[model samples]
Target chain A: MLVIVVFVLVGIVTALLWASLDAFGGNVEQTAGVYSTIIFFVLLVGTLVTPAVSGGAINGDRDAGTLATTQVTLATTGQIVLAKFLAAWTVALTFLAASLPAMLFTVLAGGVRLDTLAASLGVLVLELGVVAAVGVGLSGVIARPLFSVVTTYLVVAALSIGTLIAFTLGGLAVQTERTQTYIGIDFSVGGEFDPVTGLPEEIVCLEPETYSYPVPRFDLVWGILAANPYIVLADAAPTTFTSEGYPEDLFGQIALGVRSAQLPIVFDEVIDECGAALAGDPNSAYEFETPQEIFDRTVPSWFVGLAIHLVLAIAALAAAVARTRTPAGRLPTGSRVA
Target chain B: MTSTAAIAVEGVARSFGDVHAVRQADFEAASGQVTALIGPNGSGKTTLLLMLATLLQPDAGTIRIAGHDPVADPRAVRRVMGWMPDVLGSWAALTVRGALETTGRLYELGPADARTRANELIELVGLETLADQPARVLSRGQKQRLSLARALVHRPSVLLLDEPASGLDPAARVDLRVLVRRLAAEGCAVVVSSHVLAELDEMADTAVYLDHGATASAERIERSRATARDWRVRALDPAALAAALEAESIVTSGTDHLGALVTVSGEAEAAAVLERLVRAGIAVSAFGPAVGDLEHTYLDLARGEVAEQPVIDSTEAPR
Candidate 1:
């Protein structure tokens, strides 16, 4: 019942927020952006609530003196733990199911791509399952229900917030000194300058000036962000680009940020002011790739992150199964079997 | 112990860190008998039962529950063993019938079978009216009945009940006694542990006494039984009974309102005293041992141990 109330509340809030965006003249692409935000919020809330649902599943039974009764039955330890995992996963998915109405509202707003919908929803479901598995596993491994639940929440925080901090710190720690050369037109040599083109009449070449600065190498630590649940959700989604090479939705924007991190800092970058003045425009001299181009060049890390989460979930559950097996030898201190 | 016995345990010991819960337990209980596990507080009756129920592994021992080793093949033993824990815990959110049905499913019963079994058990435990009510609303005794019904869900051949009568009222306790006796009569081996000796006296046909984590040796038990013990003889006239007991050269210990106490060596002498009292023109209302058989033997063993080791706190000794 608590799960239902929480799910409904999140759904209603997402709906109202989406409706406000539409009323404020949200275009097709913006509508898609609003939908991605709603989906991301729903996934975030689902992940947070799933741990609470499953965290007390095993240890709570032990505290209530009900676990040993189940253990004594014909049901093996594997069956008991697996059944709990599946039940928790299903309960977590119900939160997603509750937001179906708002999701439909977003789709009706138009410009919702098929690949984006499928990939984001798939990743969201898998992430929720992973959280559920970890909660149930920790409940078995830890003797106290309260301690295990708190530990589960801590693990969630470490994945969601800790990964980001680590990634930032990691990138800043590994800096490379980049040397950039700037070639300028000798404005002092000419008396008259073109106001429209911002160039000297003679277009005389000045001595190349080299300046060095440190650049944070995010490429070295982007894998840390890969383990972040939010990053995995965003990066896994199929990003859509507009005609101007701008991201169409929140997923595309976030994915672009991760992709942009992959480009290496140019050590000997040369900016030719003389050549720019000789050409039609000075701004035309500097070349920068659009988000779409960077996204296209980079490799996707969502699968790697998803694979790591799945392995952790599996390992936790496997450890729980081993710890909870009956006819048990040594028991944890201050714990009873029944 | 014989393999055919329903429960055969030898040299079974389990410890939790420095505390030896069950140091050395040896006993065999046959099918169709309610064997009482008699012990004082913290004497490891529950620990031994846990081993038999396959919930804990013994540090050193061999345990066979219904001819299957609980450690080597816990599933085989669990299929035939039902354990009613001393602690009364029920799924608070589930209805009485729902809890029973869930327990049946855990025992591998089909949905329909589980429902049917649940209905039958609710009726058997006499909770038909409260079947739909959530378990949290149940009183202590009702919860006990539910626990018993749950343990019986699989129709196990071996039953282990720890402190089964602790919280039951008189009427419920009677019902529990009758139900356990009925189960035993159906050829299920039942082991009951309780501090209530009188209750076991009425229900159990055989008893195994545990003291300080050790089962009483057979020789020690024999010695305790052969030793002189008190018998209460109540008559229509207490004075007449006292005089009659005195006339027969019987040693009178004391007297209470209900009866006069006399020391007797064995059951034969007790019977002889009863006959002599009857011949003396005293109408005997009741003539029996002052305490139940299990309680008497248990107390005697406890006393003998204290006498042998005067320095150690008898209760704290880990046998």
Candidate 2:
């Protein structure tokens, strides 16, 4: 029943988004970008629902008095936990499967890159599995069903939103001072101004003025974003660039946010307008890097985040197995094996 | 056929934090007999059963179920042991047949064999009509029957039944008794723990009395059995029976609707009292101990324990 509701809701939302993008004369690539954004939204909803699906898998059985009966059977604790993990993962993946029609529609629209599609879906699937595994493991470890389910949600929230908050606060906490110099042409010194070009006929340079200001050192704390599931999804996907070197999709845009954080703040920047005019050059005072350039210069931390999540999942499952093993050495308070 | 113990525990002890659930439980149940684990409400019967079922670990001693150590090799014990817990719990969403089949599968039975076994167990437990219904809708007694069926899915040799008859009606209880006896006759060692002494008296071939988280020693149980207990002596004429009892020098404790109650030290003394009553021209219609064997022994042991230690153990109550 939940799967059906998710399917219908995703279908309606996808239809609305596609119609809006088409009405705005969005090209195939832009329409595909909107579709990816819709999928990301679906993934967010899936994360919330997956824990509910898997959170009570083990403890619910125990509360109902069925866990010990199964444990007394030939099945080992490892097999029981593994089976529950597999069952929960399958149930969670159903929501992803429900959105397949919309995904197919986006694919048929002719702008979705093959590598981008593979990478995004792959990460989304693995992330859902990780959440399910964590939920099942916690259900085994905790004695009560309600508390375990709530704990699963809290863990997911910590990864999805807590990491973003930590990264922002950490960057703000560490500040660095930067010195900048400014120089310009002095038109008053020239005999007559060139009206057509809005400049002096004879170039005259002004004195260089320098000033210092505090800048947030985001580069120092960019690694924190690697733990965020959304950031991991966005950053792991292969980003597409337009002719102007700007990202064309939401994945690239969010990915660009983390990549931009990696660039060090310019401490001794100089706006040498007077020197440029004297050298007979135009637009040499401002220097900026594109999203693609920033992406290239910085390291990809999505793999690191994924590895951390995998390790967490494995550790939780191992603890659960130890707790559920029988003849159990010690049980949690107010709990019975049979 | 060998005279080995089907279920054996030696100096077993278990505790939960400050409360010691089972201080020392030592007993052996051989094949082809029903052993009654007799104890009061808080005597740790269920705790001892859990340890034997391999669901719990003993803090101290060793347990062997079907010749395999439960702690060292629970799998081997589980393969030959069936436990019906006092608490009845079933999958709410699954039908009775479905639950049984699932249990069979968990025991490594094939699909076809599991289906066959489930059908057989449903019939044996007299739940044919409710086999297809979800277990949630079943009554307490019906759920108890389902729990029994699930435990017997693999036809285990050593059966542990804790409070198995608590919720059963008279007819169902009779059926359960017959079934349990039949299983024992088939060479299965059955351990039944219940608060109903009369029921155990009817079914149990042997009795193990536990008091204050400890099983009473054999010598202690024998001494308790030799303690003076009331015997009911029914007669056609109440006046004549009372007079005969007075003449026989047997002390009459009291009298109720059925007959007069006389205190007797042991079975031989009770027989002597009856012989004297009949010789004195009293029409004795019925003569037997006032309480069931298990109740008499259990109460005597409990009283002895309290008398031995005036400071009552508050932890003796059930959790």
Candidate 3:
């Protein structure tokens, strides 16, 4: 099943990559955005979906009633629990690995740097560990496999959907642009997010609509959820937050004719296009933003959230395995049968 | 200790909370033969079997399989003792081969060896056609057979079958008896617990009669003659045999296996005893000493027994 999931994931990403391949005009910035788009879907789909599938594995075996017989054997509770989680995680990773070559293209196109890829992989490993933990823990305590599966999935769903919805409603992000904003955008410090250039996204938008497009995990779009450090750092500087006309002094000539007339810049564009301002008066930018600055970038925000999820998942797995080892709950079998 | 003892229980006892299930139960099974443990329900046969399987520990007494203590050397005992529980917990979702393979692996069989053993067991249980079928779909008899196959897959030195034939039909039960006999022939000590008298009578070489959670009585039946009286009487006139019994010197007893009216000679000569019968104004009959039988005595003893003993906990039962 793990192998199957990998193939399916690969197929989907390959199809998406194949379809979009002819469309990328060799622009580094545009390619980075595409990279971000691909990873966004992978994490959401893999981390969220895999837990639900693996959550009920051991519980299902118990429900089928082989536990007592198996218990009498030399196999320990740890073996069974670990096997179930591994099977589930392996299947999910298959899908993640399937898209490896396709994801590599984003690097080739300069959508995201190799360090960003490495860091994102770290986040992925952590996310999977949490997913496997949810399945293992739920299966150990819950008798009904369906209940375990449903319950774990609901947990994953609540984390993914709930975080996005809550953060959006709380005004932490632009509400109108959902998963789409993450596409072809780089919110990371060095990412070119411009859709036309296919590179990591630069902080060029003061408002939601003018924000840098997704460049996979390299951009601040990932920070909207994961809390990556670079995204946190980028958001700390206020030069890109209020000075709308100051981004990229070189692109100012191009910015003049962006909207029609002298359009008022949004907060996103002010922060995004502040390179022009830095060239003129670097000190004129916003300073000492602190924690509030984190929300303005992608990596810091997304990683922080990702860390919380991973911690919760790992805790759940440890608890489940520990309980399975001792199974001291039934005080009635001895009393009745003896 | 009996030389043919397959499994022996010595001073075994177990208690759960305030209730005691077995107390001071002594048991033994002979090698290369079937020993039946017979008792009323709740007599702790299952508990004792489980203790022997190393699934539980008896609170007192020790269980030894071929001289090795189950509690002290469970790993070694586990490799040699096969247990078929009263209830078969079906690996319902797993195919027959898949489930057996898992157990084989746990028994430490190499992959190729496990497959080979699994195939042999599948055929032994006559499940070759259903080797890939899910356990959940099998009939009750088929499930029992599958469980039996699983227990025997390791070719253990001792086989503990707790009511292995309970749900089986008559024909299936016959097949079971044959299989068990074959196992015993291969030098395996087989301890089979059952409530069925006829089945045990046909299969067991020895009977451990469990009464009130202890070994109330035990008997080994080989080619030994019954201990009950056996008599041969020759009547000069078979029609007048009852009349001759009224004579003073000849004391009459009950009828013999040949349906003849039997009489005992009281130290008198054979002719004198016959003459005494003839003098009673009746026809004379010939008589001899009577031998004994065991089957009827065994049944009578079993009928007088009851259940009062507790089962030994898996942690403390004796070997």
Q: In candidate 1, which residue pairs get closer than 3 Å at backbone N, Cα or C atoms, i.e. clash?
A: none
State TM-scores per candidate: 0.94, 0.96, 0.58
Q: Per-residue lDDT tens digits of candidate 1, residues B194-277?
A: 989999999999889997789998889998888899999899988887788778888989998768998999989999988898
iRMS values for every prediction: 3.0, 1.7, 6.2
lDDT of 3 by residue, A1-101 (tens): 65466556755765675467647554544554456556555666676667667877766655554554565556665776777778888877766787677
Per-candidate DockQ values are 0.62, 0.66, 0.15
**What local lDDT score does residue B190 receive in model 2, on the 0 to 100 scale?**
99
In the order shown, the chain A TM-scores of the predictions are 0.94, 0.95, 0.56
**Taking the tens digit of each residue's C-alpha lDDT, what string does model 2 give over A191-236?**
7877776678888888988899999889999999999988899999
- lDDT against the true structure, each candidate: 0.88, 0.88, 0.60
Question: Which of 2 and 3 is the better model by lDDT?
Answer: 2
Q: What iRMS does model 2 reach?
A: 1.7
* Stretches > 4 Å off in candidate 3: A1-34, A37-40, A47-52, A71-77, A94-110, A142-338, B1-26, B39-44, B58-61, B66-73, B87-102, B132-138, B207-319
Best by TM-score: 2
Report the C-alpha displacement of residue B56, candidate 2, in angstroms. Answer: 1.7
DockQ-based ranking, best first?
A: 2, 1, 3
For residue B210, model 3's alpha carbon misses the true position, in angstroms, by 5.8
